[model samples]
Target: MIEILRKRRSVRQFLDKEIEKEKIDILKEAVLRSPSSRGINPWEFIFVTDKELLEKLSKAKKHGSAFLKNAKLGVLVIADTRKSDVCIEDCSIAAITLQYVAESLGLGSCWAQIRLREHNDNISAEEYVRNLFVLPDYYLIECIIGIGYPKNKPQGHDYSTLQFEKIHTNGFKND
Candidate 1:
């Protein structure tokens, strides 16, 4: 699990290959198994492979979403805010779990932020994706994870770069 965590990176370049259903199934299972607050699992995923729609989604954010255009599939993570006040946090945990599962399966993924972003010339990024995907009014857009085989593999993170100074004991210590 630590290896998977160390190896995971924000993959932007992806090969134009279809992701295997078996691998996708694993990611779905991970999401379903994610721990949620008060057992209110607020996440609902939309697995998109449509080319035209992918193009539209590429415009969901003014920036950082262009990579979705090249991804073979994109997972739009939506949270039912009406169900829980902490639905965003719960769904975010599920998203990270899905990314870890993808890494374990040799797939690459990039997270495109949508919650507070806005399209270049259109409405809010969340509204754009919701309208395009026809999501319900109560479903709040969290993020989109663009997934596919990597066109170029990025090197794993070096442990030396970790910020250990951020960690503190029971009593806070400066310096």
Candidate 2:
């Protein structure tokens, strides 16, 4: 797991190749296994492989989402707001689990945050997604994980660059 973490990097550029169905299934299982608060498992996923839809979804936000147009798959991470109080946290764990499984399978993934973003002046990103998918009002969009074969795999962040100072002892102490 540590090795996978060491090599994992957010990949925005992907090759024009479709992800294998077996790998997609594995990703499905991985997210289902993701830990949730009291096992309420409020998260849900929409595996999008349609080219036209992916293209449209790429415009979900003004920035940081254009690259999703080229992704072979877009996994919408949403949650039932009424199911759990920690819906965001549960969705986040599932999203990261999907990403890690993608990395382990020689696939690349990038996350596009949707919870608090704008698609345009008329609507929020979440609202645009809701309208696009015709989702119910009780569902909350957390993010979209764009997955595909990487066009170019960038190296992970160097260990020397890690912020070791962020780690604290038993209690929070000012420097």
Candidate 3:
């Protein structure tokens, strides 16, 4: 598990090769199995593999999302606040776990943030994605994870130094 965690990194470029169905299946299983608060599991995933649509999705944000155009698969992570008040937090954890699982499968993934952003002039990122994907208004877009065989491998963040400065024994003690 530690090895997988260390190996996982944001991969923005990909090859033209296609991902196998077995790999996709494993990703689905990992996503669905994610634990949620109160077991509400307020998350839902919309997968996009069409090249044309993926390209359009890459423009779902004004910036920081151009890589979706190269993603062999796009996992639009969303949550329905109607299902749980803590839907955002739940979806975030699921997204992280999903990426970790992807790394374990020898795939690379990059998460594009979209929760509080805009696509262009006046379209909110959530609205932009929702409109493009035709998703219901009840859903809130959390992020989009671009997955594929990396065109190049990115070295993971070196953890050897371990930022102990940020760690606290228990609670913050006022200096």
Candidate 4:
């Protein structure tokens, strides 16, 4: 499991192949088993396999993430903000867990931020997403993850050069 976590990367490019039903089921099980804050379990998932909708979503953002179009599956994680104050954190944990599970299942995944400053004030994108899923008002779009087999291996990064500079032991930092 540690090795899987270490090797997982945001794979944008994917092979032109469809994912197996059993693998998708395993992925769903991973999300369903996530631990929620205060046991609220205030999370909802929308599995998107429609190519047309994926294409539309790929163009919804300015950066133009074409990876959505190639992904075998896309999962939208929504948090019921009306249910708890820790909805965002809970939803985020679920998203990361799903990503890790995907990696463990020999699948590649990447997270796309859907709820941020750009979409909060005015939820045009959110509206589109909600309409696509026919989601009720109680739920809010938290994030979208694209999953599939990788087309190419991700490049490696060196962390040996990185160092913790400002982290304190217990009290205030000393100069």
Candidate 5:
């Protein structure tokens, strides 16, 4: 599990390949097993394979997410905020867990956050998604996770710069 966590990376470039049903099932199982905040489990998932809708979302959220175009599957993790104060947390945990699970199954995944600012305005991207999918008002689109086989492996990053940062604490070491 720890190895999966460490090996996971955001895969942006995906091959034009469809994911297997069995693998998809495993990914969904991870979501079902995710721990919900306060046991509210205020979350739902929309498995998107519609090419037209995927194209629309890719364009609508083009600013932050252009990688959706190549993804074979997009899982929208929605949260019922009215049901729990930690709905965002619940949804976020589910999203991250899904990413790791997908990677464990040899599938690549990337998380796309739905901007609240866009939703606040009637023209928000969230509004576009809600209208497209006919989602109820009670549900909020937390994120869209793009999944598929990778076209290229993720580039490695050197965390040496972060080693001397003021981020960690050892008995409150002063600068």
Candidate 6:
């Protein structure tokens, strides 16, 4: 797992190739296994592969989401707010789990944050997505993860660059 984490990087540029069905199935299973508060599992996933729909979803945010148009798959991480107050945290865990599983399968992925983001000046990114898919108002859009074969596998962050200062022992120290 640590080796996978060391190699994992957010890949925005992907090769024009479709992901294998087997790999897709693995990704689906990985997210479902993600842990949630008291196992309520409020998350819902939409695995998108349609080219036309991917193009539309690429515009979910003004920035940081244009890469979806070229991705072979986009997983929308959403959750039922009515089911849990920790929907955000739960969805986040699932999203990252999906990413890690994709990495282990030799695929690259990038996350496009939807919550608290804007598609346009007047419309929130979440609203645009809800309207596009006609999702219920109770469902909250967390983010969309774009996945595919990487055009270029970028190197992961160097260990020397890690912020060791951020690690605190038993308690917070001002030092």
The per-prediction tally of clashing pairs is 0, 0, 0, 0, 1, 0
The estimated TM-scores of all candidates read: 0.95, 0.98, 0.95, 0.87, 0.88, 0.98
Question: What is candidate 1's CA lDDT for residue 150?
Answer: 91
Residue 142 displacement in candidate 6 (angstroms): 0.3
Candidate models: Cα lDDT each: 0.88, 0.96, 0.90, 0.82, 0.81, 0.97
Candidate 2's TM-score reads 0.98
For residues 73-150, what per-residue lDDT tens digits would candidate 2 score against the true structure? 999999999999999999999999999999999999999999999999989999999999999989999999999999
* Model 4 lDDT per residue over 93-133, tens place: 99999999999888899987777524334555666677777
Candidate 1, overall lDDT? 0.88
lDDT of 3 at 148: 95
Best by lDDT: 6
Model 4 alpha-carbon drift over 4 Å, by segment: 117-123, 161-163, 166-168, 171-175
Cα deviation of 105, candidate 2, in Å: 0.3
lDDT of 2 at 128: 93
Scored against the true structure, residue 3 in model 5 reaches a CA lDDT of 71
Weakest ten-residue segment in model 1 by summed lDDT = 115-124
The RMSD of every model to the true structure, in order and in angstroms, is 1.3, 0.7, 1.3, 2.5, 2.4, 0.7
**Alpha carbon deviation, residue 67, candidate 5 (Å):** 1.3
Candidate 3 collision pairs: none
True-structure Cα RMSD, model 2: 0.7
**Candidate 4, position 6, lDDT:** 64
